[model samples]
Target: MRQHFFRCLKVKITKFIAAGMVVTCLFGSVSLGFAAPQPSPITILPIDRAKFVSGQLFDFLIEVKDADPDRIQVTVNGVTADKYFGKGAATDREASLATYRINNVAFKKPGKVEIAVKATGTAGLSTRTVKYDVVNPVAPKRAKNVILFVGDGMSLQARQMARILSQGITEGKYNDLLAMEKLSNTAIITTSGYDSLVTDSANSASAYATGHKAVVNAMGTYANSTADPFDDPNVENIVELVKRSRGMATGLVSTANITDATPAAMVAHTRKRAEQNFIAETMLDPRHRPDVILGGGSRHFLPLSTPGSKRTDNKNIIDEFKKLGYRFSGTKSELLATPPNTDKLLGLYQLDNMNVYLDREMLKNPKVLGGFDDQPTLMDMTQTAIDTLSKNPKGFFLMVEGASIDKQLHAMDWQRATYDTIELDKSIAIAKEFARKNKDTLIVVVADHAHGASITGTYHELDGKKGREAVRIYANAGWPTFADNDKDGFPDSPSPDITLAVQYANHPDYKEDYKFKAEPTVPAIMANNKAIANPQTSGEFYPGNIPSSDPSEVHSADDIILNADGPGADYFNGVMDNTEVFFGIVRALGLDGNRNVK
Candidate 1:
């Protein structure tokens, strides 16, 4: 009887074990069907599916998070990348990120190409595939010369402001249009870089110079995963290309420093715009050097021994340029006296940025001029640049920039910004006159980016309604009483009885008095790294909208206007990207991307 009972118990235990096995199999299969967590997303510079000109150099980069460098595999067009490009890949490890780069690579053929990357580590595997389109079309009839005018942050509103002040309005009609308005071709230009929607002057100008979209604060080069500003992978700019392929003369002019972003984009390549001292030295490079360089920021050119010098080294760039057969000019008188036959010219007018038109040309205030008062006007500089560069029998490329338009707008000084716009218009007129005589020159006037200010009717204190209460909108806003009485195309005074109520779309914490400041004053000041309203002013206080990191107004992502005339101007008519400007210029000049280097 005991043996029979034990046998039954064993049978029960075996059945229970069988049931447990079945349950385990069912649940294990379900768990196995679940997917593992995905790895972090990869960052690819120039982005995926970016387009490029055939034989145009660019860096190909892949960044993987928490990945091992040895486990990373990069392939181009389904083959090993290093083998296909004939160059080995470079790896950089920063913290938990692994970055692989192939520098100075170009697609010689005109077609679609693919780049694939796979990275594996303790966090698992991450894969990314990017495609690029390369094109090399034969250009049409080309222009002998090209002149590009960049009114930094000059928006449609800024143009209108200039028109109202310079052209004068009568019975809802204007007496004349600005020279830029008289252009035959116009287009809305979108200014965004690879990194963000809003772009700074550096990358926006880079798009025009290199025909590639770069990140903010970078120009003529790709922003890489490195701390060194000068070591980024470089792309040849118009200055280098034209010099290399056709030996064309190149010139750059700006109201700001020569090493500033807009002008520097024409020749210099670096990840940071603040490296002005390095840029001052980089201008000495012969490969992409400009024949005519004129602007401000003389401090960067002076040696550390000089009292006002901003350079940390003892090298004096001015003396260095003088040794290179360049006729150096330190003041407007010197620049005007520079012989027209001079092949190379370098002009530095101020220790920092040159004063705006209202102060330098009209007011001539000694305090405002800061002893560097002999700065040349934009028109004067434009004429001088054209006169000097036109001596090139092989033709020339000149970039004239009205940089202070953006600078004044950042300070929320609409009146000063308007005057600078007028200054830019006058310079454009000079270019137009040059173009009329030499029809072979393609002239393009564009803005690097747009400002936030707009005309919201008019404001007046005649009714004793001061400040915000004085603002008039729609029908109540009659024509502004700005009069160019001397026919000089500039309002005698910025603060007239009645004026345009220019409103800002975005701003930091600031005071708004609905009146102009006599001196160029900042709207906000820095306090503990936060943008705070200027305590010195009394007006309606506005809470800040932008981050505290910025102490002034910022750029907008709004589409800017581009006006063009002369040869190849027809290429610009519809909505276009900023990169298209470079292509247009290249097409107009018939630049060959694949020209064999000697």
Candidate 2:
């Protein structure tokens, strides 16, 4: 009876072990059966599953929630990260959040690299793996100089509108192509950043300045957990790289404020682009500052004691730059009068953004100019920048921006935007002329983003059918009657009898007047935190399809065109990410970021 009872007990024990194995096979692991829910997955910067250029510097960061630093293990390609990088990461703890940072790390060779992190604590065990492709590029014959022209929001439609209005069309065929259209090489550039489908100027320009994608409103820096804009992890921009590695002269010229996104991305390292005052001060840093800085935003350069100052502090940046031997110009006349031999220049034509071509030069509207009427044209600024930057025996990198194209388009003023596009083309002509002479200057013309505007048909008031009713489409849509009788690149008058019916693909609740305002005007105004049609115009009211939070038309995710000429221009062919612009420029300049300079 005792032997039989022992035999039954052994069989029961064996069955129990078999049942446990079945449960382990059904579930993930034996430990997981008794363990609590896994901890939240780790977050890493430079992200996982992305491609990086070999020798490009970026910050390595990791965040694990509710995990002890001692319990975390990070490895790169099965080896400890500290051993792979030859340096350990710095750790910081705040309550349940633990942060690990390894700054300015780069992959020297080309290959696939995997970063794995495992964290174990009371919560549970969590793991994450990030993969990166480090690319090795071949050296090319370098160009002596590179000129990048950003026609802010200059879309294909914008280009066509400029071509029609400036060059005129007769019998559906005609005169000539714009300078940008005549470039030797072209590419379709995708402008989306890592954070979103559509990108702002700051992040878009950041891609070209630094060969890394950034979040919107951020430039040359990765957005961090801190509230301080300047405290983010920085990726060295083209200005810094060129200056530090090659001792190249740099110039930034724009119709917008010098502290604005496009130009500021070339130097400033901040997560927030709207930090105008801080950006103004950062422009004085000798490490990355440009040799020629021309545009507006004098308000930020003035001290708090000054009448039109925008800065909160008593620091007078204009005075500081003057002390550093910068020749400052405050007007068109002053800019022209600046000596040709002046090595350094700081020109601020207005307290805010310099007026657009239509308002400042063509119309000369006092209301829009606001006592600052003598702003120089974008062409003037570009020519001046080129002249000053060329004085250096070493080659220079100049970024010229036609900023008001985006600004006017946001206001739903297509005519003004088209004029600015023409202005950009003229500036491109200037750069092409310079490139022709130098033979070694690489000139790239591209847009940061695209507006939601397109040319649908033609509008005519001859029949007296007003607004939307007068919009003639298809076979009925005749050619526009824009004329350039004076031989100037601009149309004689913006408001012709038969003009192009430009429409916005996306807009706020606004009136569609289908006519150009004599002065600059906003399409929608804020009321009760919502966008409402401006009562200033009379037309058919259309409700917005976009969110009410937006006061104007927003940028589109559509790809923009990039045109290039001169040496190394062949690299710009087929589709490319905006970050590739930086690589192209680097290849043209043969920049060695690891090189040391005095």
Candidate 3:
């Protein structure tokens, strides 16, 4: 089921140990097996088998539960934490928990390292030892640019739907392939975070950005025992390493609000993904700020005095960006008018998440758009970002996201989701065209997570059947009538006779109309204290297969596809953990965060 974006911090009681420590050669989290050791009073951040880019800064933290604050000792190898790093650590004493933290630290060497912590609690002595690996990725031919395409919530089924709609099939043979499907290297990526079976975008993207797994509702930081979301142990992300270590340009583009999890995780560090106001402010920080920022959520950038502003302060972020010499564009027409030589850009086309391709470009109904009608397509934003960021001679890292694939799917609108998926495919084509000239660029197209939507068969009313009766299976299910005569890669119509019969593996109580919605809608809504069918559409009622409170389809724990080409693309093959994506990018770019700091 689509995870309800939890706004509060979850109280976690972890055992402080994995099944067993395993050697990590840039593969994934250190813990390989399923069995975790018994509980310990002291829990450490950056759990066992964690890998890091050499010199990649991270916060070392040990959370001691019901322990004496002064009786805790942490050591790196044989040396004390403070003595090992030659930097002082901070210790906070709370009512039932205490935290010992050393921030802004990095491993100088490329080898196995150990962190052992001991604490004296009321019950007895609690101790744990975890191993870590630090590596300086090297490549014979390094990449100059890395364009990471995150198709948020786009499952394997989602890709097939896009292929079926954009590149029609004849007699079970495909006419063509989506741009992302043509990549030279591919791997099936596992999406779960260490904390849960299924994962949210923030946690999953954190794996790609930081090469470390984070809990749900968090990105760029591990969950801490404290109540403060920002105080979580922060891990240095790819944008930070590229910009600080190599002076590389960084860009973030998405169809969702720029402050949303998938894009924000590239830079911001927070335990809670819902902290958009804080994430908006994080963009201004020079340490890890992007050179180009595009997408919706203008409300977070506008001042509190503004009509649609979602900010709580009077600071005008747009104006702040302008002061930093960023060219601002509030509409599609203005975005295209941006000078080709423009380097820094901050474009916010809508106050909230931009309209999906179906409603914005296809329907063009201003009423459904909530007043901010002039939004640019994901392809347009991606192109502008590339044009601006590629001006930097040191190279660049850009994350372009089709954010609404998951959103629409949560509402059970696969038609809208598939159209957006096509939009992402076209955006990938834009990056592919750029890579054609610059062979030094590495393009990775993948989904942060996946939905449960699946194509079961084709539905048609030709035989005077409706609803479930019209769902034709096996040989009876002919090719869908979706046609893309315009050759723009998008079907002419979202809904047509002989449309694919899509089914959700997991869903809340909802009505199944088996039709495309003219207006975006949720299949279920709250009634009394539980979720019930919306009553807006008519068909067979799908009794809640998932939790009633979910009110929509949920995210799947199933693995998603990863496609890549260009330099460092060879690193991807066979099944891999999600965190390996970060390692792959650094290897392609030859980025080593190891640095000499006093």
lDDT digits (tens) for residues 294-335 of candidate 2: 998899999999998899999999999999999999999999
- Lowest-sum lDDT 10-residue window in model 1: 23-32
Candidate 3's residue-wise lDDT over 1-598, tens digit each? 1122121111111232333433222222232334555687888898889999888999999989988878889999889999989898888778989888889998888888999999988878888899998888877789999999999999999999999999999888999999999999999999999899999999999999999999999999988877799988899999988888889999999999999999999999999999999999989999889999999999999999999999999999999999999999999999999998899999999889999999999898878998777889999999999999999998999999999999999999999999999999999999999999999999999999999899899998888998898999998887899977889999999988789999999898888868998998888888887889888878898898887777888899999999999999999999999999999999999886874212
Give each model's whole-structure lDDT: 0.88, 0.87, 0.90
Per-model TM against the reference: 0.90, 0.91, 0.93
Candidates sorted by TM-score, best first: 3, 2, 1
lDDT score of residue 589 within candidate 3: 93
Report the C-alpha lDDT of model 1 over 1-598, residue by residue, as the tens digit.
Answer: 5565566556554665444332112321311123444444577766665667666776777778888887889887888988988899898888987888888777778898888888897668878878877776444667999999999999999999999999988889988999999999999999999989999999999999988888999998877667899877788788888887788899999999889999999999999999999999999998888999999999999999998999999999999999999999888999889886798999999998999998998788899899987889989889999999999888999999999999999999999999999999999999999999998999999999998999999999898898788999988999888877798888999989898998898899999887878778899999988899999877889887888889899999999999999888989988999998988888788766777446
lDDT of 1 at 509: 95
The weakest ten consecutive residues by lDDT in model 2 span 23-32
Q: Tally clashes: model 3.
A: 7
Show model 3 residue runs off by greater than 4 Å: 1-37, 596-598
Ranking by lDDT: 3, 1, 2
